[model samples]
Target chain A: MTRVRIDLFASLDGYASTTGGTSDNPMGEDWGRLTAAYAATRTFHERVLGDTSGTGTTGIDDSYVAAHFDGIGAEIMGAAMFGLHAFPDDPDWKGWWGDRPPFGTPVYVLTHTAPRPPIPMQGGTTFHFRNTAVEDVLAEATEAAGGLDVRVGGGVSTARAFLRAGLVDHLHVMIAPILLGRGTRLWDDLRGLDLTHKVTTEVAESGTIHVTFTR
Target chain B: MTRVRIDLFASLDGYASTTGGTSDNPMGEDWGRLTAAYAATRTFHERVLGDTSGTGTTGIDDSYVAAHFDGIGAEIMGAAMFGLHAFPDDPDWKGWWGDRPPFGTPVYVLTHTAPRPPIPMQGGTTFHFRNTAVEDVLAEATEAAGGLDVRVGGGVSTARAFLRAGLVDHLHVMIAPILLGRGTRLWDDLRGLDLTHKVTTEVAESGTIHVTFTR
Candidate 1:
């Protein structure tokens, strides 16, 4: 069975990112600080930052960062995560990840806008747009995963939708020791989620706690 | 300095207790399961349950349950917690703890109703009704604490008020592996809380994650 997974970095107050992120600053001022531990990892440096030097922390944080891409064959994300908000009117926006994005799998972007042609980038990454329900998209993504795991790359709202729908099999949330007064909350409307899932906790050296919920 | 602290058993979704609880069912349907670990502790059996047989688990969960009354001299809670909601029309109601309550300190009840005379119970527990601000009540409770630590006993709203007002010095939240779909949330409107405190995580044998925040 292709398991549906989600990995997100949240603050202690349960905010994934601050609100009012513009094209110039998609994550706002707190993004860098909130993801400081993640960005300092070897896998993040190599995959997200495109740093091939391999000079980064290789501790538990790096282990989690590396595990993110381990068995992920497909990904589902919200339109905002694909940088569609930055260029809603422009059709040439290929996301913030330059030409070769980190995800080397078929990425499904949930959006209400008209479906555009799939943008196939370097590596095996392909951006597919869909405005369908969470179940339908998960089915499509799971099929596209080809017996591998499907990763839910979220901007908070997408993951919450999937979680509320009871479709997520595993969720790894890294709670950074920071506070963003306001933004998108991951725990909203997720009451009684603990009943459905078994939770485990791991503390990282960066003072970040990794809370994993397995259904 | 007398540090004001709180210890709450919360669900994975951050709910302290379900709504519309009666005196017989103070925590609602899922309360027993949510507090099973704490209830099984010897300290809880002795203190809350009045079990003097000295039986119960004495592990990490027991350690936390035992620490709930370690340095506390005074306690603060909401009217709902004192069974005021169960007997709104009755003035002779004296909480659910029977004649000999477990608390060995002055407990302040925050309410807007008519002030009542202090009800002194055995074991040094006195229920004092206070229709005042969080700060004012904390001042009185701190004074009553006599240089010892004051506990912010909660029914969710009381703790939230104290936390939002920045009056709480330490918060120990036990995240039980159960979910209550509907209830009073403990983290509502509490954004940026991580910035003001240092968070630490500990996992108990019963799979409950003890999240402690120290200012």
Candidate 2:
């Protein structure tokens, strides 16, 4: 059975990002501070930043970051996460992740417009665009996963859509100690969600609380 | 110097209580489960439940619950919390708390109706109705506190108003492991609150996360 999981970094007030962040300033002004603990992890330094010098913290925060890529076989994300809004007119836009993206699995991008041909990158990552419902996309991603779990990469709205549709199996939210004040909220309209899932919390030494909701 | 503080018990999704909870249902259908950790504490059993026998948990949860009543001289709450909605037309409606209320100080209830004379209870709890701004209410509560801290008893909206007005100096939120999907949220419109206060989190053995925001 392939499981669907969502891993997101959010502020204590439930905001995933600050508003008005352009492609040039991708994660907004407070992004760096909001994700400081994660960025300081050894796994993030090696996987995302491509730092092979073994730099970064290696405690509980790194353990959580390392688990993010442990069993992920396929990934699904919204178009906004792929920086499509920055180059809506440019037909040659790939993504914010450089030519050699870190994801070594089949990544699906959900969009309204017709998808272009799949773009293959280094490290076995292939970007496939889909214009379909969340369930349909999940089915396609699950088939592509090859018995491994699928990850729901987010922009807040994308994750909420999947959650509202009751398709998420496991959700892990890392709440930083910062307050973005006004951005996209992850807990909106998610009333009565506790009835369906069991929630557990862990407080890290870095002041981040890891909340996991499992069905 | 007297500090203003807020203590609220909320679900993992930030809801303080579900909708349509009558005085009989007090905190809604899931209220008992939501507040199980707090209710299991010795402080709740004695202070709120009026249980004379020492019969409750006495660890971290009790420590946090005991702190709820420590060093508080005044309380400010909304009319809805006092069950005014249940007995709006009743001129003799005191509160849901019987003869000896838990609060042993002056409590200011913010409302839009005509001011009512102060009603003193058996345990030194006096209910004073006032139709005024958040600042004015805080001013009066501060004076009544007499160098002691003032507690902001909540129904979510009241606490949000005080937080929005930048009047709260300390805020403690107990994140229960339940989800009430459709109720008043405590995190709404509080985007950059982290910048103003320092946040610390403690995960209890009973799966409750105690988050405190102090300036």
Top DockQ hit: 2
For B1-215, candidate 1 gives per-residue lDDT tens digits of 89999998777656787765555766567778778889888998888887889999898889988888798889999988886487766778998778887788899988777498889998889999999989999999999999999998887888988988988889898877555656777777766676688887777787777888898
lDDT on C-alpha atoms for all candidate structures: 0.83, 0.85
Q: Give the lowest summed-lDDT range of ten residues in model 1 chain A.
A: A177-186
Residue B11 in model 2: shift from native, Å? Answer: 2.1
- Give the candidate number with the greatest lDDT: 2
Clashing pairs in 2: A181-B191, A181-B192, A191-B181, A191-B182, A192-B180, A192-B181
Q: Which sections of candidate 1 miss by over 4 Å?
A: A179-181, B22-24
| Native contacts present in candidate 1, fraction | 0.50
| Model 1 residue B16 distance off true place after TM-score fit, in angstroms | 2.3
Show where candidate 2 strays beyond 4 Å: none
Q: DockQ of every model listed?
A: 0.42, 0.59
Superposed Cα deviation of residue B145, candidate 2 (Å): 2.5
